[model samples]
Target: MIARSTFSNGIVLCCRSDDDDSLLAVKCIDIDECPTSSLVLLQHEVALTRTISHENIHTYSSVWLSKSRLCMSSLFMDYGSCADIISSHFKHGLPEKIMALILYEILTALSYLRSVNLIHRGVRCSHILVSKNGEIKLSGHRNMIELSRDGIPVKKVHDFPKHDSSMLPWLSPEILQQDMQGYCTKSDIYSLGITACELANGYAPFTDMPSTQMLLEKLNGTIPFMLDETTVAPLIEDTSPSANADTEKFKSEMIEAAKSRKFSTAMHQLVTDCLERDPDMRMDADQLLKHPVFRQIKGLSKCQILQPVFEKMDPISKKASARVFQEQEEMMDELNRMSMCDVEWDFQE
Candidate 1:
């Protein structure tokens, strides 16, 4: 038992024990206010969390049901959610290297969850938590949707409402149409794609619109929002024009490079693949982890570019000494060639 404070519809408390030391985030609901089926879904979430064991996921500690409140406990992350991280250090956007690491960790976590046939129906920055050392843990597991033996969503009382696709803007197109027959692991990929876009843009796509309007726009095939070199300059100029200039330059170069690198094409392709109008084209978590982009990033680590996931990778994946040496040489040559030319930008920072 520890100190407790109450908030709307729930209570927050500090819980400490020899076996557990973490913050307890408990949401209380009147049994009568919430549907009985919803209560069952909550219990299912607790069971699912209790079964999963992963470093990148918050550990489920305990669940308590008293007369009126349902309390759930999990490991406490000192740092706040990814929403906090994005708002703090990555307001404009994060460096490509750091972004790659974050995406890799997220993919890893999604892979583990998918292995058990669970789809984190809600995948967003707010649902991710970062530890003190920058390791990411996918929290809010209670929101995941369990799948049937055929990999389709189980028709549960808490499942998405038939007419509502407005809750999560990042959901796959298939989900929006109420196409339960087509929903599968690929749906999570669509959410991940949106998450990537959010990571790069510093906000949710089309965040300016109301939820209903956003959903309508998405259903009508509107392209989701993104921040490019020109877009980034305006938002970040006050902080450091020079750094923004460099970032914009890098973005332009990276876009060109992606065009040629089949695996490293703009993030849009991967995102769009996950958001395919036809669900058949979407990629699963395992397939995404094995993408050429991941392989290209493996090459980046060898150049002594200390990105986030590089340190956590298995030694075998990190062994690119020969390739790294060659890449460095080529990079130097490219830099030397560019030094002789004058570059002008149409967009002002």
Candidate 2:
């Protein structure tokens, strides 16, 4: 195994095959630790992936149950994910053109899913895998909703995903509201908008707030915009008379830095259209694909479009090593807090 990472309910192993020398990501879940509901979802995910085929969508190569663990293997992506890229290289987010190209490909995948009557409930940067060759594929289909029943289409769905707490931030407000009027595929568009902001800002907005507070913010139609030169700077509040000059200077510096990161009006409008508070008002995947921002890369090949981003990135292996170390530290901290193991192994130099 080259490296491994743990999530709330599973561990993903990055390894090379002995026979073919091909890289693979094997996601394993301990059957004993996994709840019955989660197990069902895993099975559903496998089935769903098997029935679909798209260049921009990830599918598993094999799935098996052995040694009290459910293991599924898929091709390992070179860049890991958009989130990984942001963490390792683009700390303040990606370039506007690169983000536009990535989102364009994502929209293509979404359009395909919509045709098959599937709602990819998860649409965050972490679920969007980036390749060394500039391809972006959407994963995280474990929480996907099938909008058709017995060959009949369902307009809206009311059920909530109980899979992960981290998804709460990306969920649409209509889903969070839980009223009589349920959410449809449009819900994913809202999440796409959030993902765009995450791509442009390096981090998701409202993540700092508690779940309930974040829920309230979304419910109140507080949409997060791209953090770029065009975005208005938040007011700097300082009461100290001695600190006034320092605050002004700091604010001026922030403005100057932001000036270098200006995004086009079309990009801003696309995000605004997708993030409409009302599900009906939000642009669907097909509509979003037609947005003006996507036109910027109409004739460009994937390599041409993403070459700058690739050039800007640090070495993938170095980034992965650093990220793996950080993830290990976090996982160890969480495991210790749970007190499931009596013995502790220190991983310090």
Candidate 3:
């Protein structure tokens, strides 16, 4: 191994392989000597990542399992998560232009996933990885499903493992029922809306709610979207999802909550389109990508969009990338703490 760092969780080590001062590969290890469920999940992640590729998606190169540990090698990402930037640099929100570009990049990836009939079951702000080059990409393939060949996502809520419970706030109403409905790309569109809110306000709408309450809120369409106080609140967050809070204060509080990163009407509109309660009503990735907010990015190269984000990262991103070699799990924790950033984490090529 070129470099390695192990975690106390079931996950073992994650490292960057380097050659001639450029990234060669990213290796992930899962220590499951007892043949556990987590081992299967790790293997699934490896296979899924290896199968999918887009300029904005992390790429897996190879995978193999030893007697006890499962190892996966993929492209390295120097930027950690957009959460790091929100926590550190834009606690209130991100600029409309940057958020627009980032969402555009993600939709590009999502469009590719849809073409293959896949549902990125989990698409949250925390899963969005960035690089110092300002390139934004998505990770967390742990819960994805290939609907093309598989027919439908795993049935029964029991089939979903506990580790992914944190993602409930992003699940669509149809998927939250006791009798699960077939989750498709539209389900992901709902998540993309929540992620947009998280991107705008630095936290998901229901972060403080208990897990069960969050589930009910999502099921009943009670959650809000892009409710930042400083920026223009999307009209839909008020109308569509059944409102549970004092709409006046919910509106006033967000208006009062520190609005550090003001965005635009086009970005807000994009979030509204994705947040449409009816799965049938939601815009697919391809449709949302065509919205006007993304028009600002039409002629620009991916690198051009990323350059500003790279320049905006704080020093914490550099330290976190380095520390990933010392404590992979801790580094992950740091990403949530809003203390890290990433540089061009792609392979040398």
Top model number, lDDT: 2
TM-score of each: 0.63, 0.81, 0.73
Give per-candidate clash totals: 0, 0, 16
Candidate with more favorable, higher lDDT: 2 or 3: 2
Please state the error at residue 328 of candidate 2 in Å.
20
Deviation from native of the Cα of residue 165 in model 3, angstroms: 0.6
By descending lDDT, how would the candidates be arranged? 2, 3, 1
Candidate 1, lDDT over the whole model: 0.60
Model 3 per-residue lDDT tens digits across residues 52-74? 77888876666666665555665
The digit string of per-residue lDDT tens for model 1 on 149-196 reads 455645321246332233367776667666446576667777877877
Cα lDDT for residue 250, model 1? 50
lDDT of each: 0.60, 0.82, 0.67
Candidate no. 2 TM-score: 0.81
| RMSD versus native structure for model 3 | 11.3
Clashing pairs in 1: none
